[model samples]
Target: MSKAKKVIFVIVEGPTDEDALSSVLKQIFSSAEVHFHVIHGDITTEDAITANNAKSYVAKRIAAEMKKYAYKESDILQIVHLIDTDGAFIPDNLVKTRTEKGIQYFEDHIETGEVKYIQERNQKKSSVVASLCSTGKMKSSIPYSIYYFSRNMEHVLHNVATELTDDQKVELADAFADRYEENPMDFVAFIESEEVAVPGGYTQTWTFIREGTNSLNRHSNLRILFEQENLKSTD
Candidate 1:
């Protein structure tokens, strides 16, 4: 029998995230096993996570995934992490206050009753995210990279409505997967379209998001994934 295909683990926060891109990723990385591992919540914003321990935390998560899947380190190809920006990198002044408790994310500002809460979350989340971004490989020597969809994954995946129920999120993801299931490569084209694509190489693109309110707008640096796979996205 042929050797088992190496695993390409795509880490995400929840099922909707996995549902949205798992099919297309499997298609795109046909030579490998494309696995979507949902961690159930944003680890970046967790109370214990900080820049100091973020990598070790993620490394443990990856180890756990390997155990759960029965995959050896030798059986791993790479790790690709997909995260929502959630306006985490925006400056303090851009976060506007609100009467109601709901959080409303706009193109250039966020409206929320918990300004201090968001600010604290941002301080914690951004540092952890930035810590992850600064590294090219995990301590285990596995090739790793993180990509982002600003505001949230749903926003970049063609669903424009600001608020969605979990059921609605799943529906959108399934629909998106089906829309490109026949020609999953087309997903690259959609994400790389003029309006959604963040223009730059890997590091430069990350730099771009940290500037001004770009992180709150609808944008993504996922085109870099296609580029890594030697697939050119339309300019």
Candidate 2:
């Protein structure tokens, strides 16, 4: 008889994170042995998004499932979580506390919880990237990945879309430099070198789990993590 497949549970912050990261993982690891199990904590409904309720809505839902399932600590399961370090000035003790709480919440539902957090520190680059998308620049032909632009430049490429006057281009470059207090080249290098939150960092945790548990290495490559199978019901 075929052996029972081991399951790994991964929890992430949102859906966009799921799409960008999960797609790459499935493509790279499907050849490896073992199946992946994923649980999405994203709130896809418009009502949830409009009410600014995704984080809490997803969190509560995950907690409920864990309560219903009697998962134990000895099972070969993995739990991964992504957290943004907003400018809350949260105390170190509180950070530890919340992190432990998150782990326990999963352990209570599934066996063997492995929780990891990717925090944000470089505020300027993050703000610029976020604003570009929210302000509708992405729709006009700006692909979101920083790799698309000059990776070595420090400025924000000033208008990613549309032809600009020479003077306007120079002004935009200067504004980006002034805002970040760094040369465009240096800024680009820093961003590229940093450990970024993967495009679908949260959603692809299941892909990571499947490959990691079956293989000898545990590298969290964005390209490899996004391609895993779609999430399955945690019921």
Candidate 3:
């Protein structure tokens, strides 16, 4: 008998995030099933949903999708959420709580002199899972992980090519999609190479793609989420 396929669900803020992540994750989870569902909004808004309510919004959506597909909770090995950190302020209460809990959250000072908040991986995972299962409307317990781009999707692509115009960045993303479709592993290898680089003095988004000894190492939220999920699958 064929082995059962493990399903992993990703909830992204918009098409760009979905597209970029789908390309990378397809390679990362080659043996398993990965699904990307767009929330049709930025971190702040998608119809009536806001960043503060994203957890609830995603949980309801997950429940609905599960019902539609008749998938039990066990069928879903994990649920990952990707959102841009632009203008999405971390609640003070949350910050205080996490700090008190001794979570290792950090503040990244960007070139624009703005501070970007990164929530600890453990905190984000536990909080998201709690929010999802807390509804009590879903049938099974599903693990959850949340990640955020430093500023926005466009910013990340721009980091890959600081000299590129907005139009050029879009083209680059499309090229990445094409390359990914043709050979996912090769695409990952390309990302892992030094060919991808963020502009000096900017938040190092490329560090998520490539492991290096830079000060920004392991700072990529998506990288953390993906690595955690990968580890879980192995266990």
lDDT of 3 by residue, 83-199 (tens): 554322333223332223223333332122111233333234334333432343333467776555444555544354133455665676676677577576664454444433333
Worst 10 residues of 1 by lDDT: 226-235
In order of listing, the candidates' clash counts read 0, 21, 0
Task: List the candidates' TM-scores in order.
Answer: 0.94, 0.26, 0.56
Q: Candidate order by TM-score, highest to lowest?
A: 1, 3, 2
lDDT of 2 by residue, 145-208 (tens): 2111211111112313333455664565555545444333343343333232223343343233
State the lDDT of candidate 1 residue by residue for 1-235, as single tens digits.
2237877889999998988788888887887888788989998998888899988999899989888778887677788999999988899988889999789998889889999999888888888988999877875677899999987999888757387889989899999889987798688898888878999898898998888988898889998888775222211
Model 1, runs deviating above 4 Å:
1-3, 159-161, 229-235
lDDT of each: 0.85, 0.30, 0.50
Query: What TM-score would candidate 3 get against the native?
Result: 0.56
Better of 1 and 3 by TM-score: 1
**TM-score of predicted structure 2:** 0.26
**Over the full model, what C-alpha lDDT does candidate 1 score relative to the true structure?**
0.85
Which lDDT value does model 2 have at 52?
A: 40
